[model samples]
Target: MSDPHIISAAVQEQRAAIVSQRDFENLYKQYAPFLLRVCQALCHDENLAADMMQEVFCSIWDRRTTISVKGSWENYLYRCAKYQYYNHQRSLSRFRTVQDSVFAASDESDDSTQEHIEYRELTHNVNQLVEQLPDQCRKVYQMSRGEGLNTAEISKELSLSEKTVKNHLTKALGFLRRNIEALFAFIFLIS
Candidate 1:
């Protein structure tokens, strides 16, 4: 394979080169293998890698007469594949947050005994973390989270100012967040 820097420099010296059909085919033949490997490594999925590689070549072919590379031809193609992969990922735009996953799994995977046990264990661990909070913070958290009460409702029920309830909830949540991350990792591993 020719060095991309040398090809890039030569093309630059000759001014912008036109990518005719023959040039496009040669470029595809030359770079497809390497580009596919790069995409495969980045995506970690063979089908996705192939799709990305095909998109890169197809796009180049579509814009054969107009597309211009400012730097190395290899680098330009690589960036095209990378951009296509990212665009595909962004297009998914699905919600996969941990809270959604954990809670959703409990409702959806009831057939699995193992999952139920894991959920029970996770619940127990979370309760333990909640118990470790200060008395007022723990009470505020229980009212807000366990009782599904809003800030105003909790304030009225506890006979405390809204701001004070908010502060307690914040402190309790922060403490739980710092502690829950490790437990979540363990659940993720076993599940």
Candidate 2:
């Protein structure tokens, strides 16, 4: 091989005309083997390495018409290859990171499903407790809490006075609080 600095200097001085077809062919012959080896080291596939090497040569050929070099051609080729490899690895890492994040989100969805099941069980228990209330109290409680109605709205719906609605709510709340306290104590003892 000729001196890399002299080759680069010649290419730079002559520009398009100096980088003739023969010169391009020689450069490909001289550098393709080493460039492919570099690509293989980075990509770990012979076919991919060959493809990347071909791309590198094509890029260099396209830029040969205008590209100027101030240093050794060998160094420039290696640097370009190294940058391409780094960019490839960086993109691969980003894809892996996104995949990992999606996997983690899937796990969270599983946790959310378990939480929803537990919530449904709790709602069922509370619904059973509500059913045990006096019919009028249950109706008033449902009307007040479920529909987000005011005492006046509940009063109107049940044909009861506001004071009667308040009395039903108070009794229902007292019964629920006492029952819940006793249930908690029983659970603690059982556990």
Candidate 3:
């Protein structure tokens, strides 16, 4: 009584509607190698391509509930592969940036250690010269240079006249210059 073509068509529609678990499994198995090949062609790296293929399949599985396969399944899988490839490329770029920063910081630390050693040596030599100054002159010099005080502030703190403070700083500078010149001359002679 019923047309066979119509009945067959109805059964086919029912089968599409159900979308059996076995069909999805077979789809994954069939397309996996193809997807991996597509990924490899895009990335040119086997391990990265494999990772992208897995990510693409995981994304598809997550959205499988609402999937309406309009065109060939091959086209859809290829599009997914393309997106995954781009995403992986972006991840690679970010990883490179992090690696570069880590290397740059290590290099900076090496340079900083050299600079710190030079600074310590210079400060130690200056401290030794400062220690050789007269007691009151040394205190005034420390307040002016170490504590960053002006002559007026140093005079107020030490209960000395501003003229006296100025004289102390001038004497301290003359002492440091003479000491540094003599030390450099001695080093040159030794060398």
Instruction: Score candidate 3 by TM-score against the native.
Output: 0.46
- Report lDDT (Cα) of residue 14, candidate 1: 51
Q: Best candidate per TM-score, number?
A: 3
Residue-wise C-alpha lDDT for candidate 2, range 1-191, written one tens digit per residue: 78999887776675433267788888888887889788898789875565556567767877876766556667777877887677656645655665566467567677877657756876787788889999999998888788899899999988999977876775666556546555544534553
The number of clashing residue pairs in each candidate reads 0, 0, 0
lDDT of 3 by residue, 1-191 (tens): 99999987776554343145776678888998999899899989886676667667656666666565545668878998998777656645655665566467567677777667756876898899999999999999999999999999999999999978876886686568557656544544553
What lDDT does the true structure give each of the candidates? 0.76, 0.72, 0.75
Per-candidate TM-score against the hidden true structure: 0.43, 0.43, 0.46
Write one digit per residue (lDDT tens) for candidate 1, span 53-107: 7667767777766676887777887788889878656533322355577778778
**In candidate 1, which residue ranges exceed 4 Å CA deviation?**
1-10, 13-18, 94-191
